[model samples]
Structures are given as structure tokens and as C-alpha cells.
Target chain A: MQMTKIKHHLTDALLMGYAAGTLPEAFNLVVATHISMCDTCRAALAEFEAVGGEVMLDAEPVDMAEDALADAMARIMNAPQTSLPKAKPAGGVFPAPLRDYVNGDLDRVKWRKIGGGVSQMVLKTEGGASVRLLRIPAGTAVPDHGHRGTELTLVLQGAFVDETDRFGAGDIEVANEDLNHTPVAEQGADCICLAATDAPLRFNALLPRIAQRFIGI
Target chain B: MLNEMHTLAKADAVTVMPVYKRTGNAGIRATGANRVMAEATTKRMAWVTQVAAVRDAKDKAAFAELFAYFAPRVKSFLMKSGASPDLAEECAQEVMVTLWNKAHLFDPAKASVSTWIFTIARNRRIDLLRKQKRPEPEDLPWGPEAEPEQADAMGLQQETEQLGQALAALPAEQRKLIERAYFGELSHSEIAAETGLPLGTIKSRIRLALERLRHTMK
Candidate 1:
């Protein structure tokens, strides 16, 4: 975790709009995808929705139309049964640039060990940049590492907690090189995170040097 | 009636007519459109119904029951989202009508019916907001209020109470963070600015708040 490498714009946009109910459908879909994999973002969005729900209570009540339900029932009782269209494979794993960050071959990439029970895979982005996926065993504390570039991490499963927050499945943590911190995975589940990085990680310990040489951290 | 029946036959020969017909072009249009839209809506509704069908009539009934339960809730939702009472009522009516017309679209795999319906309400609210030429006051409903004790409103009141209780169970810190972010219309940074807290703290607080809320709701 890097203290200065916080790239929270996507998270910010998602949290804000989700709270406001103003997020676009496409964006909401992406956000949903991210939240499903990342626990931190899910929690954040949930908080936003709850808050919105509360504010709604304070809103002045509106009178419902006389026949709204009857109309709806009439429509439902009369609605014809139909089938869903077939699922189509889009050009990318996801619909946008984010897709490229994921769906890459995980096995072929070089794996670098950064700490005990932690390994990383560095992948090249379309922008000719490199990103890393950091995997830690359950209850392992990742070595304190500072970021050197923009870092976007999406949690595929499990969860980890830092001094400031806890991230779970589908939660994305965006950070820059300036952010410095260490994250410890929760007991009983491995923390697997998909991280897109533009620069090398700055490891804080001598043990990392030995691990980096073989694992490429 | 003859003209509507003619249109219905041309669209989908299998379409069902309303049990009773009202008067005038409005009634004619409603009946005609309902018949046609029901046919059109079923194509999507089937996706949802397929999932519901497997669970049992109890499940199906629960799904079907959503119309009576949520139509007014959605109407009230529209009203709070800045629609007039009348427009909210209209939108609510349309939403339920849509729910009925597209009941088959309910896919339990993709989302719960509540979330799906909420998504529909959300989209409709956005469309309505976009169409407004001049912005009105923050809290006023756009249309005339219907009677509060109306059956629909009463139903909404009950559901809302349940939702409210769920919300209230969240920790005060988490709940307040959610409130400022959603109701207060403050950005994370803005919240940081107003509260004079660090931006990270605000974001973290919001994140924890949401997690707690989800746990409570579940």
C-alpha cells in the first residue's frame, strides 16, 4: 500500500453518483462489476445508498395516482411472456479500457515475491504501462511499499485491511506512488487484488530485496 | 374498440384484452396500448418469470405482489426525486404498468426484484429530471399531491417504514456519513471540506458506513 498513490477518481465518481442515483447506466454496470469483485467499494456504495435512503425520508411526501396499482396490475396480468436475447461477447473482457487491465493470461506472467505469502504479476497495459496484481495469503501482512505511479487495484475475492480501511471482493483501491502503507489480509481468506500500476513498487524491507530478485516484485 | 382490436390483431394475434373497457380515446388508447405493450413487454418479462417459475407460486406470488407493493413506493420515489405529485403519480403508474408489462424481465440471477425495480425507477427519475426546462425548488413535488391516505400511498408508507427501520439500525457514524453524502449532496472532498476532516477519513467513513448498512439489510 502506498500512502501517496491514491487514484480514487473512479471510486469517487461511483460513490457520489451511486448515492445521488445519477450514475449513467453503463458506468453503473461497470461500478457494479467492480463492486462485486471489490469489497471496499461495495461497502462505500452501500453507505451512499443508505444515506440517500435516509434523506428520502425527510423529503416531502407525494400523493400517488388513484389507479397506479390497478394500472400496473392490469399491465402485469396482461403482459405477454417473452424470452431474453442471447448473451453476446463484447470486443473486450469488459466494455472499456478497464477490460484490457483484466483478462490477461495470469499464468504466463512473471511472478515476483514481495513478502511472506505474497506474490505479484506485472502486466503491460495498452498505454505501454505496467500494472501488478498482488496476491497475499490469508492473515498475511504485506510489506510496507510506497507507490511510484498511479495504482488501480480491484479485489477479485477475499479481503484486506489497512490503517484507513478494509477492502473486500470487488472493491477497488486506487493509489499513487506518494501513498505509503501496508495491508494485512483478513484471517481465513486469501486477498487477491488486480492492480494496474505505471511505476515500480518501493519495498521497505531487506527481505523484499531477496524476494524481489526471484519473484520480480 | 373496433379500431383498437384491429391494431392489436395486427401487432400480436395472441394479445389479451382487458377484462373491462373504460370510455373515450384515453381508455381506448390504454386498452389498446396495454394489450400491445403487454405483448412487447413479455419478451423481456419472460427472462424474469423463468427464474421465478422455478421457485414456486409462493415465489411467483411474491414477485407478482411487487406491483401492489412497490408501485406507490416508486411513485413516492419519483416525487422525492423532484417530480411533481401528479408527474410522480403518472411515473409511478407507468412504472407499475411497466412492471406488469415486463414482469418476465425479472432475472433473479442478475439482481433481486427490488434492486431491478429500483434501477428502473432510477432511470425513469433521471429521464424526468433531464426533461425539465427550468429547475424548481429543492423540496417541492412537481405535480399536485394525491390524498396521503390513498391505498397506494398507504402501501408506500408501510414499505418505507420497513426500509427506514433497516436504515436506522446502522451505526450513527456510518449513517451520518451516508446522509451527508446523499441527502446533503456533498462530494467526498466537499464533505472533507465541510467537516474539516482529511479526505481519506471521509472516504473511509463512507466505505465503512456502506458495509455496515449492507450487513444490516441482509
Candidate 2:
């Protein structure tokens, strides 16, 4: 079977930092969001957590204050509940079709229209699971491009098709820089996806030759 | 209730019994009575406000309640991240205390409390790791036992025993790759490099492995 390579750096960074508990709060939020939606990343994270847990069992024990447990509970009894802050998308609430596609702390992404037919939103999650949301206009075709790194894409709405396969809402495609393919939106709709990539896109189109200079697709 | 009281009495005895045993049973009775009174007071006030009431009050009781549930988990997390046990313990306590002080700062609409706590623990763990000098390669803490093979064996054994059943149920290639990556921490590149397979193949294997694991875990 022909295979597609999913980028590894961002996912690896996310798993490593998540396992080590070294991810920053803002980035961690994005990882959590992505994990909520991405089964592959979620399972990868669980494995990392399990490994970390095993490592902890090997560490020497630290004694809490004899009264620490009791004190903690007492404080709990006296504590109060409050509303937590919501993470609003930096650009604004995403359209409904895009919600399932995006993950992580929403505030961290900086969305910019980098191309005529596309808008890109970038998110930095720890361990390199940086996120990019790409929205392609209806009937437009993205430059035939290969990745210099692994890329994972989840379609939130609409449809796109390459020579090998069709991606519809909720379909996930993992690609690498080795395989270059142009994705054209299916008739009558735009294609929006949540993508995690390690490096820039290598545009194969004449337009992108000029376009890539400014956009770094 | 009597069982709980007995446990409390035993715990309290460590400090009080030494003095009471020499001073006479009078002090024991006094201390026991005091514990009973304290326990009763705690129970009565437990209902003073539902823990969730902290949401509106300047102080949040629910945050404390959640911290109590997860702080130990966070402490163990730090230790695993390579913080000395002493450091881990200190950091754990600090996190819980911060939870208390910052309870009002929580915003549930953005992430669950567990996720929020996990983020805090993650940041703190990073801070602690960044401050330390790297350990000598030889001095690196080995697995708790001397047998590296046995450790991997046991880890696989347990993973298979618990997750093995699930593994058996996965596609053959997926299971193999998962065993290699999840248990081995082999990167896709490393897996490909070692197996002499293309990187794409490794990615698919891992992706499939994870998908299977997710289904099994669920």
C-alpha cells in the first residue's frame, strides 16, 4: 500500500514535554485540545504518561508533612469553586465546520491570510506539535506540494481530493515531504483542515513559486 | 465511623502517645477528646458551603478539593521528570498551595480542571528540570533494578498482559510497531532506520498502533 508520512517533530515534542510535564501552560492547552480530537496523538500521549509513571515508581519517595494530607483536606473543605476562563479563538470563534478540526489553547494561534485562496493560523504546542489551520476557498487548488517534514491533517469541513484519495469532513491524512500532491476542493464547497507540520511546504505550482516567497506555505 | 476514629487515634498517637505513655493515661484521654472535637468540627463545617461555592466566593473550595485529589499525582509527575524527590515534594506542595491562592483564577470554560492542573504541573516540572545540571551519562539513574533486559521484559510483559490482549486483537503489523515504539520509545525515524523500512511505513504503523490502542483503551 502507498503510505503517507505524518510529521513527527511537533508530535514528538508534544509527547515528550507532556510526559515530562515540561510543556508550558499555553502550549499545553493546545496539545490538550488536539489530543481531545486526535486519537493517534492521544494514544501516543497516554503511552508517554505511562512510561513517565513507571519512571516515577523508580524514584525515591518524598515524605509529605505528617499532617499534609489532613491539612490539604481541611483546606479543600474551606475552599470555594469559581468559573474558569474560556479560551477564545484569537481570530474569533471559528465557524462551526472548523471547530472539530482545531485543538489546543485557541488563544495561542496567530491567524494570517498568507495566500489569495488560503488563510493560515499557526499554533505552537510543546515538543513541536505546532498547528496550522489552512482554509482553502471553494474551487481553489492548493499548490502541489511535498513536506520537508511530517504533516497530519484533519478535515473539519468540505472535501478535498488528490490523485490517490479523497478527504471529507473528519477524515485525517498523514503526509510527508516525500509525497507531493495537489488537493483541490470538491465542487460547491471550501476545504478547511487542522494540520500539524514540522517545516514549510514545498510548493509545486508556478504561482506558488512566487507565492511561497511571501507566504512560506 | 469508629474505624475512622481509630485510624486517626493511631496516627495521632505517634506524637501524643510518647508523652502520654510516660505522663500517664490522663494526657491520652485529653488528646483523644481534643481529636474527637476537631473531627466533629470538621464534619460540621464540611457542609458550610458546597465545594463548588468557591466559584462565586473570593475563595474557591472546589479548587482545594480538586487539588487534594490530584496534587500527589503531580508530585509523582515531577519526580518522574527527574526532579529530586525532595524537590518534587516541595513543588507538589507549592502547586496545591497555588491552587488555593489562585482558585479564583480558574476558567472552566476553556479547559477542564484536570487539564488546567496538568498544565501547571507541566510548567513547574519544566522549570525544575531546566535549573539542574545534566547528570553524567554513567551516573544517570538506571532502572530501579540492575537487569535492563528484565525491566524491558517486565514492562512488555505487563503491557502485553494488560495491553497485550488488546495488542493481540490489533492488526499484526500495527501491533509489532506499537510494541517497538510505545515500549521502546523508538522514534519513527529510528524505527525506520533500525527496521530498514521507509519512514512512511513507520508512521503508518505507529498511526495504526495508536488508533488500535485508543479503541482498546476506550
Candidate 3:
């Protein structure tokens, strides 16, 4: 995959949580997808994971069963000797992680219209957070909204301009309850994003508020 | 949770540190920091060699040595993460088998052996306990073409060692918090609740290692 200039990156807490294997699956999807596209975050994740390595190293040792090594050796004999295939060139705009969720690339996503020229497909995930793929037609504006909790929006195709700034491909915008803003797709291309929200969003406009009930966003 | 993560945002803002840059023979100096760094480099490179022996020769003796040292530790790690003794034992064995199988993929420049094992074990925990799908980043387009430069590997190993030392040296309370987080005792929300965590203290060392890895990638 070609590298895009990624100005926004994951936070330390999210990185640490991912490294520690504590993030909810939806959030892990977002983190993995973002890291796939952004080398900077990938390097940061390695750092966080190193901390986990040290933690494990420093744990008090526990003795294994008397026959454990022999058992493992036998198992190793039976186990297929697998080596990682070298990474393939990406097939589309969605990275490997996102593609796994979609079952393929962009075309495979099963989107449901939420109204106003926007469509989304929520992926199955466990725990409290929810992740989805959103497609916004070019020049369309998503209704103004404030988050009830943390919302992570990662641009996958094209760009969007919010009150905060412009987010292009590979840029992730981390929004919490404190910020309320309207985001509009840039005029040139339809914007596709991978968004994960820990809680339901509260729409600023009344009509979409009713739509939110049916939309399950 | 928002309040705590907001604090995280603030903490992140103030903690960025300069990457540790090295020049020729800089690690050889006898002065305090350099001496410690060089010593760490020496002490930590052995694991890399042991992993290579397993990969290149399928050396059973080397595998035995590694198992003897790391298996018990891996068990301990799993147990701490709330695995039952039996489950932890079973999974720890699986983790070792994975290590031997994937030995060829080990990249010393990117991660120390322990770090690599930690990732494998971590994935196993998520799979075995949570039964969750763990999404991983795409691998770099190119695999390590050959054994990486010894210096780059050594530098990473040294940084990892220093990071361990720093964790050991942290005050008991802060260290316990970090340990709890790593041990899977703390959820992300719970980790956010901890206002006094010293995560910033170790960020610089990690950043330094990242810079080296990035430089090597280039």
C-alpha cells in the first residue's frame, strides 16, 4: 500500500490497550486498520507491545507440568511448519484488516441506507463498542452531531472537512463527547470511512434524531 | 471514562520526547548512560542468536534451552492474565510450538524474542479465552531479505532491556498499575480511570526504538 501523510495517529491509551489485548474487538478493528495504513502508528504500536513484552518477562515464573516439554515437542512434530507468506500488494483502498471484516474489499460491503445520500454497514463485533463502514456521497454533509462517548473516524477513501480540520485517506479523527461538529465530504470524491463509536451519537438535527433510532448508529 | 481519556489526551500532548540518536562508537563510551546501554546490548543479544539457531538448524538442544527458560515464564504470564492453571499450561505449550514453527519469521531489528513471544501469547489469550477475532496490521510489503544488521538488532535489544530496567525501577505503586494493565487485569475503561499512571515516563525509550526501526526500514 502506498503511504499517505498521516497527520493524526492513535493515542497512547488506545495503543497501550491494544498492546495489552484489552481493547474491545470493534476498537481493535479500527486500530488494526489504521495501523495498516499508517506506519507512524505501526511503529508506536510496536513500542507499546514492547512494554507488554517486558511485563511478561518480569512476571513470576510458574513451573510447567513434568511432561509439558515432551508434550510440546510431540505437538511441534505434528504441527505444520508454517512460515508467513510475504505481504501481498493491497487489492484495494481498504487495508487487510478492514477487508477481513468486509469479506473482501469496498464492493463487498453490504450497506444500508440511513438516509440523506449516506449508507453504512455495521460489522459484527463484541463488547460495548460498534464499528461500521460509512459511505458519504461527494459534497454531502453529515448532520451536525456530538458524541455521547468516544468516536473514532478513519478516512478510507476521499476526504471530509469537519469543524476541526480536513481528514483525507488514512487520517483518523478521534472525537469524544466534548466536540460537536458537522462533517461534509470534500467535493471531488465520495468519502468512505471506518468509524467506531463506544456509545450512540446524539444528532443535532431533530429529523436525523428520529432516523438515529431506526438507523442504529 | 471521557474524563479519564481527556486526561490521557493532555498527558500525551506534553510527553513527546526527542528520539535517541546514536553515532559511531557512541555506545562504546564508559560514561554512565552509554555504559548501561552497551551492557544491555551485550546481555540481550543472546536470545536473538538462540532463536536463529532454532530457525536455521532446528537445533533441539537450543530449543530445549529456550523452552526451559521461557515456557515457565509464559505460563506465569498466562496465569496472571486469569487463565486457569490447566488452561494456561495448555496454552503455554501451544505458544512454544508456535514459536518453533514461526522461528523463521522472527525479526530481531523490529522486536526482541520476548516481545515477539508476548504478541503470540497475547493473541492466543484473546483467541482461547475471549474467542475474539484479533485484527492485525498488514505485514510490510517486503520481508526481511536477510538477517538484519547486528547493530540495529542490538540497538533494539538494548532499548528493550533498558525499558525493562526502567519498569523495575519505577515506584512500587506506579509499577503495579503498569503490571496490572499488562496482566489483563485492567480494561481500557479501568486503565483510563487510573489518573496517576506513569506511561509517559517510558514513551521516550519506545520512541527512540521506533526511530531506529523507521530508519532501518528506510
Candidate 4:
């Protein structure tokens, strides 16, 4: 594992939404990928899940159908027993959740060049938000843009520096409508990020803004 | 060898819940409330044993006991979360069946039985109602495997009980907000709108558990 310190993390509200299973699939993908690498967020997620559990426990117990147990038992007997196969260690940058979307590791990603030596592969996810893998060449800067809603960018490999701070592997940058900054990949390695945006980005450059529609970014 | 023996002793201690007879009298809480609290905690602990039984022995009676207790609660949760009664019923059954199948995945040192069941039901709701795939975190192959100490499991269960009591003691409005959040009634923005949920202390214990699991994985 490349040992770059993770500075940014998932927000409490986002973690709670994930625990409640209410986040958009795109956001969930980003959160899950981050938690896979960051144990701090993993533990935080467990705490939110514990809160969900208590809420469920406090719910008034409604009566189920009289034959519910018997029916469930029958189903259990008929259903094929499923043992969750332990996930194989991902030797690549993408974690299990992102790997599932990419169909494999980083090498499997089918990249599409948008512009400026920057390439991306959009993963299909339901809901209003969109997630994609962005690969920026060494020392390259992604076009300056501001989010309309929320955008989550998780560093999978290498590091990126924006006006706010440096985000390295396992770090997640949560950008809302307030921030407009250009993220530049560090000089050593090409930065690979799994980013999810709830709304379209308003690019500062007119050319990229025009290209955004063609690229569906 | 000593560590193995210690683990065995702790496992034995956790299984003590099965020996206690179910009071089955939900209405008895009006009189001896303290005793009811103890019984509820014991009943919660018993679920750990029942899950283990279903996992190791495929014990039908144990599965039935778990179904009887949790199925109604799961259905009620789903119904409150906006699933129709019939859909809740169907999903509740599926959730129970999933419980039986995935019993081995339940780690008492990490989560209480209710927590485990809540996650299953929540995932099912997302898949069925929202029709969205839930991307789960990758599993650690070794699991909670430093041969989880029985003390850790007991402490976690106790903390979970305390958490439940704390939640129950919250002001009605605050409690209702929390319930709504977990029931999927609140959007992310709405959840952010609310503030000051009193989730204290238990977070450290869960974090410790995760650390232990991570350690064992290595």
C-alpha cells in the first residue's frame, strides 16, 4: 500500500445518510470506497450504523402475519445457502466497491479523454449524482470549476493539491457550491481519483464548459 | 493454548442467555420495570447465541426463536420507513432468511444483534424500494479474528444497551428526529439540518473493535 497520509474524510451527515441507506448510489460508492481504505471513517460509519440500530429497536413492534415465521422458514430451507466469499485482496488502486463498478482493478477502467491530457471513465449509477474515475497526468491541473450541489473526490492513488489543501491516497475532499478551485496532480505520479458529483460543475473556462455537454461531465 | 482456553470460557459465558426462560409478557413492564430492563438486555444477548446456533448447527428452533422476535420488529421498521404492509412483510421474511444464511458474518464483539439486523433490513429496503445498489465496504478475510475476547463482546452489548436507554431517554422531539433519520424519512440535507445528537462514548468502543478487526486481518 502506498502510505500517503489521508487528510480529508467523509462528513457526518453523509455517513448518516449511508447508514440510513438514503444516499444516492453514486455517493454511496464514494463513501464505501473511502471507508474501505480509511479505518477512521470505517469506525465512524459503524457508529452511525449503531445509531440506526437503536432507532430500529425503539420502533413500535407491529404484528406480522400469523404464518410469517413458517413462511420464512420454508423460504430459508428452499433458498440456496449463501456464504459470502471473502473479497480477494485488491492489489490495485480501486477498492472492492469501485472494482465492482469498474469490473476489475484500475487497469480495467475504459478511459475516455475529455481534454488537457485528462481522461475519465464514468461509472453508471442510479440517482441524480454521478461518479467517475479521473486520471490526471503528472503535475497536470484539472480545469477550474465550481460545484452547484456537492462533489466528493476521493484519492485512490497519488495525490492532488487544490487551493484548500493537499489530498493524498485515502483522503476524500468534500466540495460544495462554496468552493471553486483547480486541483493539480503532484509531479511524481499521475493522480487517480474516484469523484462523485450531485450536480454539474460550472467550468471557469468557456471551452471546457462547452465541452462538458459533449462529455456529459 | 491459554488464549484458546480463555476464548472458550468467554464464549460459554455469552451463551448463558439461552438458559433463561422467556417471560413473553410484554405488558409486565408496567410493574417491575427494572426487571423488564434486565430481561430485555438478556434477550438481546440471547440473540447472539441463537445466531451462532444457526451458523454452527443449522438449528431450526434457534432460527425460529430469532424470527419470532426480530421479524415483527423488522417489519415494523420497514412499515414505518414507508414500505407497504405487504411489502414489509415479504421483505421482513427475506431479511430473516438472510439472517439465517449470513449468521456467520455476525460479530458480537463489533455489533449487537439489533444492529446487524437493522443493516440487513436497511439494505433490503434500498434494493427493493429505491432499486439502487448498495456498495458495501470490502470484507476483511480474517474477520474479527484475533479470537475476539468474550469480554469485548459483553462490553459491546452492554454499551449497545446503554445506547438504547440513552435514545429512549431523549426528549420526544429529538428522539422522533433520530427515528425519522434512520427510517429514511430524512434526506441528507434534512439530517444535516438537525443538530446535537447525544452519541457519546460508544463510538470509541466501536472504533476499538474496528482496530482489533484490522489488526487480526494483518
For TM-score, the strongest prediction is 4
Query: What is the Å distance of residue A211 in model 4 from its true position?
Result: 1.4
Which structure among the candidates has the greatest DockQ?
Answer: 4
What is the clash count for each candidate, in the order shown?
42, 26, 0, 0
Query: How would you encode candidate 4's per-residue C-alpha lDDT over B93-211 as one tens digit per residue?
Result: 99998998888788887889999999999999999999999999876554425535556666677777777887888888888887888888887768863445556456788667656
What residue runs in model 1 are displaced by over 4 Å at the alpha carbon?
Answer: A1-13, A23-33, A36-61, A77-83, A86-92, A95-217, B1-69, B101-116, B131-163, B169-184, B191-218
- B62-100 in candidate 1: lDDT tens per residue? 333444346666666666556777787777767655554
> In candidate 4, which residue pairs clash?
none
Across B1-218, the per-residue lDDT of candidate 2 in tens digits comes to 33342254333222221211232221113256356533432222221221224434433333334434456666765665566777877777766666655554443211224434545565566556654211100111112332223222222223312232343456677545534442224444343323222123223333554454445544
Candidate 3 lDDT at A14 equals 82
Candidate 4 or 3, higher TM-score:
4
* Each prediction's whole-model lDDT (CA): 0.49, 0.48, 0.81, 0.82
Q: Give the higher-lDDT candidate: 1 or 3.
A: 3
Each candidate structure's TM-score, on Cα atoms with residue i matched to residue i, is: 0.39, 0.47, 0.86, 0.88
All candidates: DockQ: 0.13, 0.12, 0.48, 0.51
Task: Give the higher-lDDT candidate: 2 or 4.
Answer: 4
Count of clashing pairs, candidate 4: 0
Residue A34, model 4, lDDT: 92
Give the alpha carbon lDDT tens digit for every residue of B1-218 in model 3: 33332333243211132122334563445677678766666545666776776787675555666676789999999999989999999999999988899897888877888899999999999999888999998766444465566666766787787778777888898888888888888876566534243343234544565455566777
Model 3: CA > 4 A from native? A82-90, B1-40, B189-218
- Residue B62, model 1: lDDT of 35
Across A2-23, the per-residue lDDT of candidate 3 in tens digits comes to: 5778888887778889999988
Best by lDDT: 4
Q: Candidate 1 — what's its lDDT? A: 0.49
